[model samples]
Target chain A: MKIPILRLERILLVSIQVDLTDNDAMQFQSDLVEQVAEIEALGVAIDITALDVVDSYMARVINDTASMVRLLGAESVICGVQPFVALTLVEMGRDLLGADCAFNLGQGLEILRTRIATRGDTRLSEDENV
Target chain B: MRMSELPPAQIPLHETADVVTARRAARELCEQLGFGKADQTRLATAVSELTRNVIQYANHGECVIENRSTATHRCIWVQVRDQGAGIANLEQALTDGYSTSGGLGAGLPGTRRLVDQFHIESTPQGTCITIVLTKPL
Candidate 1:
């Protein structure tokens, strides 16, 4: 299934609610990268609160996707990792998720907005109205 | 320690989706066995990694989860079997940062640390891995 990517101003929001297979994960990765480039988004926040399990493969996909977003010139943050999932990943190994993280979507967006504001770059007029 | 057995639940793994199915089933069983939230997540994550390996390397496999609990033991046992090319290097596979599939190489070793017991038997015919989680009741 396609994970919807919503655009607000120059930012992208993606919420993954279902457990994704390997194929689905790859598809989502490519799709998110394509959208980031197509929209020239400034920041991205991926919410995974609904996911109960983040296995090695899934963790790899998310980490790679976040790096891909940064390579495309958009800052990204993974938001709302469940507590148990965090414990499991840490117990398994280190560096499973190397991307930036936050407690929830609201905090994720706050981080994104703050980073984008302090980036020392020109901001779009739409950002001025926010 | 002595333990009594319950009927095991079996899940056939043919594709990626089966990985999710297997983990979910294991998590539900952990819940019924009165496992804590952390143990449940750890078991589910370990199941996901092992089942995904079954599809990635073996192409097909099966996961059997048995609840072996007794008056003084709360235990959940799991076994995964695949009828495909068995792992060639068990030692290397278990070593950290060693992978044949360009992965992070955390599947085997990482799984070992998540549960109380882990064992593996592999040959040219196939591979079978057994893992168990137990708590004193």
Candidate 2:
């Protein structure tokens, strides 16, 4: 089934509550990317607190999704990774590379806000240079 | 241990749904055995990795979970068996970051780290991996 994506201001929030199959994961990636572009979102927050397990494939997909979001001009943050899932990912040597992480959704949104603000500063500087 | 004696719960690993089923069953068994939440999560994650491997590499397999009691301790024993192409280089396969399927190759070795006991026997005919996690008394 499709995981719901919510829009709050310039941020897109996706909370994965179900154990996603490969197909579900792939579909989520496509949907998130498309939604990010359609709304010109500034950031994406993916919460996986309800997910108990993340295999290698899922880890890769999460990383890829973060990269895809960045490619579409949005910052991405992964939130609510359980302690056991963190340990397993580390041990599996599948670090969620290139993806920013947060302890929970609140922190994730805060981080995204900070990152977007920083990006705004950089763009302002670039405009002044031009 | 003999499989016939254990009356184990069997989980067929054929697809992603089966992986979820195996992990859920493992979590229930851990709960019934009085495992803490962390321990329960560990078992569930390990089961997910092993069962997913069965589906990804072997295309089909089965996981057997049984409760075993010894004079000193009680433990849950799990066996995952697959009839498919066995690993040619067991050492490399067990190493971290060695995945033929573009995975991080952490499934088998990471599973070993999570449990108390681990054993494996693989050949061209099939592969059987067994692990045991004991309940602290």
DockQ of each: 0.86, 0.49
Per-residue C-alpha lDDT of model 1 across residues A1-130, encoded as one tens digit per residue: 9999998888899999998989999999999999999988899999999999998899999999999999999899999999999999988989888999999999999999989888964463456555
Residue A12, candidate 1: Cα error in Å is: 0.5
Clashing pairs in 1: none
TM-score (chain A) of candidate 2?
Answer: 0.90
Instruction: Give per-residue lDDT, candidate 1, residue A18.
Output: 92
**Candidate 1 runs further than 4 Å off:** A124-130, B1-6
Judged by lDDT, which candidate is best?
Answer: 1
Candidate 1's error at A125, in angstroms?
A: 4.6
For all predictions, the C-alpha RMSD in Å is 2.6, 4.4
Q: For residues B110-133, could you state the per-residue lDDT of candidate 1 as single tens digits?
A: 999999999999998999999999
Q: What TM-score would you give candidate 1 relative to the actual structure?
A: 0.95
Sequence-dependent TM-score of model 2: 0.88
Position A126, candidate 2: lDDT: 23
